[model samples]
Target chain A: MLLYTIYLVAIVAEAMSGAIMGMRRGMDLFGICMIGTVTALGGGTVRDVLLGHYPLGWIAHPEYLLFTIGAAVVTAFVARYLHHLRAVFLLVDGLGLVAFCVIGCDIAMSAKMHPAIVVLAGMITGVFGGLLRDILCNQIPLVLQREVYATVALFTGSLYVGLLYFKVDSSVAQLASIGAGFLFRFLALHFEWRLPNFNGDRIRGFE
Target chain B: MLLYTIYLVAIVAEAMSGAIMGMRRGMDLFGICMIGTVTALGGGTVRDVLLGHYPLGWIAHPEYLLFTIGAAVVTAFVARYLHHLRAVFLLVDGLGLVAFCVIGCDIAMSAKMHPAIVVLAGMITGVFGGLLRDILCNQIPLVLQREVYATVALFTGSLYVGLLYFKVDSSVAQLASIGAGFLFRFLALHFEWRLPNFNGDRIRGFE
Candidate 1:
C-alpha cells in the first residue's frame, strides 16, 4: 500500500520532468501530454511487457493515467515560473527515480525472476522513461550519457534484493532502498558525475 | 503459414533499414544489431504487450531475434553497395509493413478488441518499429513526418477487417490486404505523398 502511494508520487514527478522537456522543445499541448504520460508510465509498461505481466498498471488503474495527464497540464502552465527552481525539480526527479526503482525491485522479487533479470528490471524501470523522453525530444538519452543515473537504480535494486536475502522486513527494505538511491542520485547530480562514454571508436575501425 | 513467412521477410527488411540508419549514425556493431533487432521486432512487441499477450513473438522464437541481428551485421558491411538497391528495399519494406498490419489485425480480431482498437493495434505494429529506430537514431520519425506510411497500414488493417467481416476467406483476405497496402505504399513513395504538419502555431501562443 505504501509502495503504491510512493509509485504515484514518482510518476507525478517524472511526468513533470517530461512536460518540461517537451516545452523546452517547443512542443504543443498534445505533444507535451504525450511526452509526460510516456515518461511517467513508459518504464513500467516496458517492464511489464518484458516480464509478460498482464493488465498493465495504468490500464488496470485508469486514475494513474489521469494523474499523469494532470501533472503534465499543470507543468505546462507553471514551467516558466519554475525555471529558477530547477534544483528542486531535480531533487523530486531524483526521489522519483528511487521510488520507481524500489517499486520495480519489489515487483521483480515477487515474480521470482533470475537475480540478474530482477536487477535489470529495476534499472530499466528507473531509466527507460527518461530514455523515451530524450528520444522524443530528439536528444541523446541523458541516462545513456551523463550522470550516475542508471547506476543508482542498479545499486538500489541490489540493496533491496540484499536486504530481502537477509530476511529484512519488506517496509524497511523499501525505505532503505529509496533513501539510499535518492541520496546517491542527488549527490551525483550535484557533483556533475557521469558515466564514461564509449566514443564509438569501433565504428571508425570498421570504416 | 503464408503470413508467418511474410512476417519473416518483413522483419529482415526492417532490420536492414535499422542497420543502415545505425551505420549512418556511426554506431558500432553492437548498436547496429540493437537498432536492427528493435526495428524488426519492436512493433509487434508493442502490440502484443498492449493486448496483454504473453510470450512475445521474439521470445517465443529466439531464431527471429538471431535473424534480425544477422541481417543488421550483413547490412553494416554491404550498405554502400545496397544503396543502388534502394527501390528493392523500399518494395520489401512496403510488403513488410503490409504483412505486419495484416498480422496485427488478425491478432486483435482474434482477441475481439473494439474495431477502432484493432485498427490502432495494426497501425502500431506496422509503424512503431520505425518510430523506435528514428528515435534511437535521434531523427524525426519518418512516419510522423513525410510519407503515407501509417495511413497505408491503417487502410490495410481496415480492409482486412472489412473483408473478414464480409466472410472472405482468411487467407484470401490476408493476401489481398498485403497486396493493396504494398501497392499503396509504393505509389505514395513514388508520388512523395505526405501528411501536413501542425506547424507549431500554438507553441508561439505561449512564447
Candidate 2:
C-alpha cells in the first residue's frame, strides 16, 4: 500500500514536470498531455517490454493514464504559479526516482534477471522517463549530460540488490535503498556534482 | 523469403543512415553502432512492445544485430566515398520502408488488432526507427518536419489493410502494397511533398 501510494504520487509529480517542459516548447494541450503521460510511464513501460513482461502497467490499469493526464492538464492551467513549489517538486522527484529504481529492481529480480541487468533495469526505470521526455522535446537527454541523476538510480538499484542478497527484510531493504538514494540525489543537486562531460569537438573523422 | 531478404537489406541500409547521422554529430564508434542498431531495429521493437508481442525479432535472431553493427562500422570507415551511391541508396531505402510497413501490418493483423491499429502499426514500423535516430542525435525528427516520408507509410499500410480485407491472395497483396508504397515514397521525394506544419508560436498560453 505504501509503495502503491508513492507510485501514484510519483507519476503525478513526473507528469507535472513533463507538462512544464512541453509548455516551454510551445506545444499544444494534446501534446502536453501526451508528453506528460509518456514521461510518467515511459520508463517502466520500456523496462517491462525489454523483460517481456506482459500487459504493461498503464495498459493493465488504465487509471494511471488518468492520473498523468490529469496532472498535465492542471499544470498547463496553473504553471505560472508553480515556481513557489519548486523545492517541494524537486524533493518529491528525488523520492520518486529512488522509488522507481526500487520497483524496477524488484521486477527484474523476480524475473530472475542477471544482477547487472537488474541494476541496469532499475536505472532505466529511474532515468529513462526523463530521457524519453527529452527525446520528445527534441533535446539531448539532460541526465546523460547533467549531474549524477542516473548515478543515483544505479546506486539505488545496486544497493537494493545487495541488501536483498544479504537477506534484508523486503520492506526494510526497499526503504533503506530509497532513503539512501534520495539523499544521494539531493546532495548531488545541492553540490552540483557531475560526471565528465565528454567533448567530441576535437575528435576528427567518421564525419 | 523475399520479404526476409528485403528486411535484411533494409536493416543494413537503415544502420548506415543512422551511422552517418551519428558521425555528423561527432559520436564515437560505440555511439555510432548504438545509433545504427537503434535506427535499424527500433521501429519493429517499438511495434512489438506496444502490441505485447514478445521474443522480439532481433532477440530471436541475434544475427540481425551483427548485420546492423557491421553495416554501421563499414559506413563509419567508408562514408566519404558513399556520396556516389546516393541514388541507389535512396531507392533501396524507399523499397525497405514499404516492405517494413507490410511486415508490420501482417504481424498486427495476425494479432487481431483493429484495422486502423494495424495500419498505424505499419506506419510506426516504417518511421519510428528514423525518429529514434534523430532523438539520439538530439534533433527534431526529420520525418516529423520533412516531406511525406511518414505519409507514404500510412498510405501503404491503409492500402495493404484494404487489400487484405477484400480477401486478396497474401503474396499478391504483399507485392502490390510494396510496389505502390515504394512508388508513392519515390514520387513524394521527387516532388517534395509535405503535410501542414502547424506554427504553434503564435498560439498563446500553456507556457
Candidate 3:
C-alpha cells in the first residue's frame, strides 16, 4: 500500500512538473498533454520493460493517462498562479526524485536482479524519464547537468542494496534510501553543487 | 541477404538525413552523431518493443551503434556538398520508408502477429523515427502533417498484409510492398497530394 501511494504521488508530481515545463515553453494544449503523459509514464515504462513486465503499466491502467490529461488542463489554466511558486515546484520535484529512486530499487530487488545491476537500473529508472523529457523539450536535463542528481539516486540505490545484503527490513531500507536521496538532492540544490567536468582535449574531440 | 542489403541502405539514408538535419540546425559533432543514431535506430527500437522484444535491437547489437557513428562522421564531412540536393534527400528518405516498412512487417509476421497488427506495426516502424527526430528538433512531424507521408507506409503495409493473406511468396510480397510505398510517396511529392482534414466540426466537443 505504501509503495502504491508513493507511485501515485510520483505520477502526480511528474505530471505537474511536465505540465509546468510545457506551459513555460508556450506549448499548445496537445503538446502540453503529450509532454505531461510522457513525463509521468516514461520512467515506469522503462523500468517495466527492463524488468520484463509486459503490456506496460500505463497501457494497463488508462487512469494514469487520464490523470495526466487532467493535470495538463489544470496547469494550462493555473500556470500563471503556479509560476509564483517556483520553490514549491522544486521541492515537489525533489520529493518525486526520492520516491522514484526508492520505488526503482524496490522493483529491481523484487525482480531478484544482481545488486550492482539493480543499482544501475534503479538510477536509470529514477533519472531517464526526466532526461528524456528535457531532451524532448530541448532543455538540458537537470539530472545530467546538475550536481548530485543521478548521483543521489545511485547513492540511494546502493544504500538499499547494502541494507538488503544485511537482511534488513525492506520497507525500512526503502525509507532510509528515500530520506538519503531527498537530503542529498536538497543539499545539492541549496549549495548549487555540481560534478566537475573533465575539461581535456579528449572531451573536446566529440565537440 | 536482401533484407540485410535493404537494412544497410536504410541506415545509410537515415544517417545522411540526420547529418543534413543536424548541420542545418547548427548542431555540433556529438549532436550530429546523436541525431544520426536516433534516426537510424529509433524505428527498429519501437518495432522490437511493440513485438515484445526486450533490451532493444541496438542494445542487443552494439555494432549498429558503431556503424551509425561511422556513418555520421562520413556524412558530416560530405554534408556540405550534399546540402543542395533536397529532392535527392526526399527520394532517399522515401526508399528508407519503404525498406523499413517491409522489414517491420516481415518481423511482425515472423512473430505470428495478426495481419492488421502487423500492418499497423509496419507503418509505425517505418515512420516513428522520423516522427521522433522532427519532434526532438521542435518541428512538426512530417509523417503526421505532410502529404502522403505515413499514408505511403500504411498503403504498403496493407498491401504486404494482403499479399501474405493470399499466400504470396514472402520475397515477392516484400518487393511489391516496397515498390508500392516508394511510388506512393514519390507520386504524392510530385503532385502535392494530401489527405483531407475535417475542417468542419463533424465530431463535436473533441478538439
Candidate 4:
C-alpha cells in the first residue's frame, strides 16, 4: 500500500514535469497531455511488460491515467507563473527517483528475480521515464548526461540488497533505500556533481 | 528465416532514417549512432517484451547493434549530399512499416493472442518506432496526426487473419499483408487522405 502511494506521487510528479516542458515548447493541450501520460507511465509500463506482468498497472487501474491527466491540466494552468520552479521540479523528481527505485526493487524481489537483475531493474525503473521524456522533448536526458543520477539509483538498490541480506524489516529497508537515493541525488544536484565523460579512443565501446 | 530477413532490412532502413535525422538535427556522430540504434530496435523491443519474450532480441544477439552502428556510419557520410532525400526516407519507412506490421502479427499469432489483439499489436509495431523518433526530434508524430496510418496497418492485419482463416501459406499471407499495407499507406500519402476530426460538442460524463 505504501509503495502504491509512492508510485502515485511519482506519477503525478512525472506528469507535471512533462506538462510544463510541453507547454514551454508550445505544444497544444492534447500534445501536452500525451507527453504527461507517456512520461508518467512509460518506465513502469516497460518494467511491467518486461517482467511479464499482464494488463499493465495504468491499464488495469484507469485512475492512474486520470490522475496524470489531472496533473497535466494543473500544470498547464500554473506553469505561466512557475517560471522559476525548476528547483521545485528537480526536488519532486528526486523524490520520484527514490520512490521508483525502491518500488522497482521490491517488485523484482516479489517476482523472485535475481538480486543483480533487481538492482538493474530498479535503476531502469527510476531513470527510463525521464530518459523517454527527454528523448521525446528533443533534449539529452539529464540522467545520461550532466549528473550523478543513475548512480544514485544504483546505490539505493545496493542498500536495498544489503538490507535484505541482513534480514532487515522490508518497510524499513524500503524507506532507507528511498532516503539514500533522495539524499544522494539532491546533494549531487546541489553541488553540480556529474560522472566523468570518457575521452578514450574507442568510439564503439559501451559507456 | 524469411521473417528474420525482413526484420533485418526494416532495422537497417530505420537506422538510416535515424542517422539522417540526427545529422539534420546537428547531433554528433555518437548521438547519431545512439539514435539510429534506438530507432531500429525500439519498436521490436517493445513488441517482444509485451509478448513476454525473454532476453530481448538485441540483448540476445548483439549483432543487430553492430549492424545499426554500421548503418549509422553509412548514413552519416551519405546524408551530407542527400538533403533532398525526403522521398527516399518515406519509401524506406513505408517498407519498414509494412514488414514490421506483418512480423508483429506473426509473432502475436505464434503467442496465441486473439486476432483483435494481434491486429492492435501489428499497428503498434508499425508506428511505435516512428513515434519514438518524432518525439525525440520534438515533432508531433505523423502517425497520430495523419489519419489512416494506423488504419492501414489494421487493414493489413485483417487481411493476414483472413488468409490464415482460409488456410493460406504463412509466407504468402505475410507478403500480401505487407504489399497491402504499403500500397494503402502510399495511396493515402499521395492523395492527402485523412480521417474526419470529431466536430461534435464534447460529451459530458465521457472521458
Using TM-score, give the best candidate's number: 1
> By summed lDDT, which 10 consecutive residues of candidate 2 chain B come out lowest?
B25-34
- Model 2 C-alpha lDDT per residue in residues B41-68, reported as the tens digit of each score: 9999899989977767775666888899
Two-way DockQ contest, 1 vs 4, winner: 1
Give the 10-residue window scoring lowest on summed lDDT in candidate 1 chain B.
B198-207
Model 2 has a DockQ score of 0.13
Q: DockQ scores for all the models shown?
A: 0.13, 0.13, 0.07, 0.08
Per-residue lDDT for A95-136 in model 2, tens only? 999999999998888887767668867987988898899889
Fraction of native contacts under 8 Å reproduced by each candidate: 0.15, 0.16, 0.04, 0.08
Cα lDDT of model 4 by residue, A1-207, tens digit: 877787888899899887766665555455566578778888777777678766666644667878897998777666655546767778888888878888778778888999998898788888888787777767778678668889998999989988988999988998888887888999998998889998667677567
Q: What TM-score does chain B alone reach in each candidate, compared with the true chain B?
A: 0.96, 0.97, 0.90, 0.87
- Candidate 2: which stretches are off by over 4 Å? B1-53, B56-131, B140-207
TM-score, cand. 2 vs. native: 0.61
Per-candidate RMSD, Å: 6.9, 7.1, 8.1, 8.5
Error of 4 at A110 (Å): 1.8
CAPRI classification of candidate 2: incorrect
- Which ranges of candidate 4 are over 4 A from the true structure? A53-55, A198-207, B1-48, B51-126, B132-207
Q: For model 2, which pairs clash?
A: none
lDDT of 4: 0.78
